[model samples]
Target: MSFKSRTLLFVICLFVVSNKLVATPKVKTIPIFNIQVDSLIEQQSIRNDMTQLELLVLYNDALKEKKPADSVNIFKKLAILNADLGQPEDALIYTEKYIKNTLDFSILNSEAYNVIRGSEAHKELSENYMLQIDWISFIFLYVALIGFFFTVIINFSKKANRCAKLFISGFVGVHSLFILEFVLYISNIQYRLPHTYLIAALTALLYGPFLYLYFKSVTYNFKFRTIDLLHFLPTLILIVYLFPMYSLSSNDKIEIMLEINNSYNINRYVIFISKVVSLFIYAILIGKFHYSRRKEEDSIKGKKPVNRWKKTIYAIHVIYLVSYIIYGLPVSGLMLSFPYFINYIQVSIMSVMVIYLAYMAYVQPEIFKSYSVGTSENTIPPLEKYQKSGLTNALSEELKGNLIRLFVEDKVFKENNINLEELSKRLNTTRHNTSQIINEHFNINFFELINKFRIQEAIRILKEDIHGSLNIIDIAYEVGYNNKVTFNKAFKKETSLTPSEFINMQIKKGLYK
Candidate 1:
């Protein structure tokens, strides 16, 4: 046989063998669910380090086992994980599945909501979705909270009423926790501090009582009593009730969180409602107190009194009431939808309130100062009788001369702690008569009269210090003001310029050497 013909025959034989081998069926291997694989997947999920593929596999396994609750939770976690991993489309699909399988709307406060609201996929689907919250709101809220924190800190450091400082500190503590939760929610962080919820709740419960005390401190003579500690009993009881949960392990805490989030807990709802009721009651009490005080002042003085400071505080209380209502409606089931817009409104109001508070702290430091009239009765004969008496004119002139000498020559206004009673003592007259003399002769209250002298002294120092040897703070201390903010404000109010501006003007006019 020829070599080429023999080679062709061999090739045909090889092709026939290959066809036979291809026609034969091979055994298939199936993967078994083993303890190692299950353990690894669970560890990943527990650590919140599961990949999308791993989560899907676990989710499918849960579904295969007919574990609906486990499957739903896995799906919810998958949604959040995908969102954090920047897979918004997958996150939305998983979120839809979570909603469909569980029939649960409680995910509105979860990271899933943040993902959906911020996702372009969701935006493309619904342009008119007014329920969406923007990320800017979080930024604004954070800024406002930071401002509140610093304002409280600065106020606490000031020589203000101790009760007022304590109240502001309480507010700072409660709101700081709230802001922490808000940050965690927006960032999709899964970790929580132990007893965070309990601490926040207890602090929230203290808001009304703290506010009431703050008002009392500012509006009247307030002294701390042992009985005042009773206001914290509700918080103490709640702390005790939550002590067991606080001691739970991390896994146990996660389980409890899931249960709380998936369904309404009656106890939690009751506590929330109680908080709203307490705040509302406090608001009414504050309003009543303010109204009665204003009425008394009007009746006694026979004129409209300057209550801008008090009015600002009252407005803040009203804001708190409004915010509680807006927040409580959705939380207590009184409203179907959580009014996300209320967050913006509340933050805006709080920002403005903080700014107003800062302004008051700067411009009217005396508002925070404790002032009290002496016990001397206002029975210094009627004004008509005093005018009819020949001694009235002589007494008025003598009082005026003494006041000028004390304020200008003696520089008594340089005392930061000077008050109406102290000045009356210095003038060697009754507090009522001294106050009357200042009101009638100076055409202003004791507060304004003292500030006028202090501001004048500040101007004199600023004008004389041409070598720039004195800073604004130095001038503030030298002129009976403990804080430069207050001094600058008073200087501007009296001379229409801040201390620096006034100094610059004096320099420009060649008034300084």
Candidate 2:
């Protein structure tokens, strides 16, 4: 109750009240022991007040100690702590460092890091670091690589149609490069090498044109005219439009790529939509050409030339067209969503086309031969015997086609006096050029070619029930063989059987009525 004691009690009470009002700064405790992952993880969860600076110190200590596991754990903790603190840029840097050390993407999906999920830096981190190789990507890469070699083989092939093969090679080459670019995108290498960004995009314009050219060349023996070069205008324009981007430095390009919003780019949408349009238009053109040729073949009833191959190719074109449209819808922003797996459908269809082309090139190359036989003679040196001949390749090809038509369709070989001079007159060429065409194109002399056709005709007559009544001499004269002896000799040479023996075999097999 003394006044001095009352004043001392009041002062003590005031000091306690001031200490409670102005709180002490909580000290960040550092363990004297070495940093360990298990202890840090427990502390990170329990010590919610832990600062990123404390985690950074622990991460640097782990690195100095050459403990990779502890360093990666600290990096992840720093990333999450920064993300929760609303510092997405800092969080992204730490996230990338963590992923580089651990190759783990699980942290990206953790709800604890949601604050940074929509950040450009975070997106770059996910895209650049979350590298994966899907099985479909591998398959596309493998098939495209094989397509490259096959393209080379056919491009250099001397036996098939030169113009048609060139277009086929172009088609395969473009698809292979496009698929390779896709593989790189899937593998996250596109971000590393910015130059590869639009390389595949331009190739889209080429696919339809190449396919059209191939169909035209094979069916109609089409040679490129000046107007045909217009098919490349779109691709060339795209190249010019993209040139500015292509000229940018790698660092600048990557900066642009990392900042690009998920929304559609008008220029990109237009370019891609045009490609789909080009494909659609060319598909119709190719289908029209193919149908017209098919109708002609059907009317003539001559042996169909690569009819099956042409049909298969057109069918594949249609399939690819549908798949590409579906895949392009979302990618070009015509549709709402782009499921990444949708690309697999189009790429698989392209792979099938590539494989089918390889099959045709290997198994049925003869069907690809065009009417312009030996047109590649300019590239390949002429044979020694024909080096001095006056037969130009174009003229020789014309004569050869006509001569084949004469024998196979017109049955001119059934004429008893169808000598080289007579055949040359019918072909409207010099006897020497006609003779050279036979030797160079068919690898046989004029008489040998005529005799071979005659023998074939005689065999056909011998096996036919209607012609079974014709005797050997009568058949010999009918097939342009003046005598039975010459007919028997030619038949024996062609089929290892005389005319009488061929008829007997047919009779024994019940081929004749």
Candidate 3:
């Protein structure tokens, strides 16, 4: 064959083989990325290293190619990823998007809208994405609204003092920002630049001091030093640099995000050093607190109150450490586009510490005193005087005062002939009223009070050297009790034993030693 004939024949053979080997693209199906991206939810199907994100990438590619089998997994993964990163409101939006995709897919299954919708998977498989936004919105609205009101009520409490009030204000502040972000997204009036690391950096920087303050509050009785505010210096500068002119467009936003990420590059290294330093500081504090508290506790006779705040402080400290560690990973460098949930969790922990500190500082100053064992007695005085009054709680003040005065101050039990009627008459009241007062106010009958005082008189007699030889009956009669039986019963009831048993037990226990 000539050169032209041979070349043409080779080309024809190659084209024929290509046609035979390549199967026709099967009947079009929904692309995985479209399903995953649109699926947009937290589902059982995709997890583990957030592998679902990979599926989402695939889904988006498939959708771009107009692949058909409906899937909403991408949005689901994003939602979960956002939540894992500690952005619930962001997660909520992603979930809503996933739901919308499901709700729009098919309405054949009424179960999707039902209250008892089975597993989350069932709901996705059955519905389209459209109906979900409203449902999710309502639920998110309900949660966000409740969170808002609780925030407001917490903010308004009278006992919540100025610093605490500020903390509560910030407590509501973060959630409010979340609400604003959600509202803006839902309204589509604004947009957050995707994969922007600046937000993550700003979050860490902005909340670091707040976190530190929170740490100080629960962990230490914190008094702010000038340096405490300095932790936020990076964020403050970042914010000031955020002139509207600088952020005039998305490019500006991206530029800012890039800058912020770069700052994290700088500060995270510092944060690492700071964390290492913090760990050492924490170790020192632990050792000091342990040593100091142990010495203090030994001076008193009780187990020390654990430096309970240390646990909370340690948690934040660990978070600081973790943030530094995360910054070290290559994935972390890329993923700084969004702060991890750990970042947000650290922020929340800090906020809680702040709120807790505020409570300790202002809302409940008693917390400050709580660490003081000496002050505990002053917090709630014993009711001994009231207990000794002997008048019923139900008695009128005048009657009670008179009763306590006549019976207690004057040692009326010394009069063997003292009777309830006589005492009632002296107080200018009926016997029944006096009886009721004694029963209610003193938690004892009148006779019981008299017997108690008589027992005390016997104790006085026994203490005197001359009366040591007196038998139970002799002691009883001398103390104004008519019979030994009455004295024994009264003695046992008052001192948990008979007179003979009390003296003998006390002697055996070495009180007499």
TM-score of each model, in listed order: 0.51, 0.55, 0.33
Candidate 2 segments whose C-alpha is farther than 4 A from its true place: 1-77, 80-128, 260-266, 298-305, 372-513
**Model 1 residue 81 CA deviation in Å:** 14
Query: Candidates sorted by lDDT, descending order?
Result: 2, 1, 3
Task: Give per-residue CA lDDT, model 1, range 155-272, as digits (tens).
Answer: 6556566776667556545555555554444333323332343445656577778767766775555788999898777778767766666676654544444453433233666667
By TM-score, the better pick of 1 and 3 is: 1
Taken over the whole model, the C-alpha lDDT of each candidate is: 0.63, 0.74, 0.50
Clashing pairs in 2: none
On a 0 to 100 scale, what is the lDDT of residue 323 in model 2?
87
Where does candidate 3 stray beyond 4 Å? Answer: 1-155, 164-203, 206-208, 211-246, 254-310, 313-324, 327-513
**What tens-digit string does per-residue lDDT give for candidate 2 at 257-365?**
5544323232667767888898899989988877766645432211243767888888998888888888888876778876778797788888888888988789877
Which is the leading candidate under lDDT?
2
After superposing candidate 1, which stretches have Cα over 4 Å from the reference? 1-152, 155-158, 190-195, 258-266, 297-306, 373-513
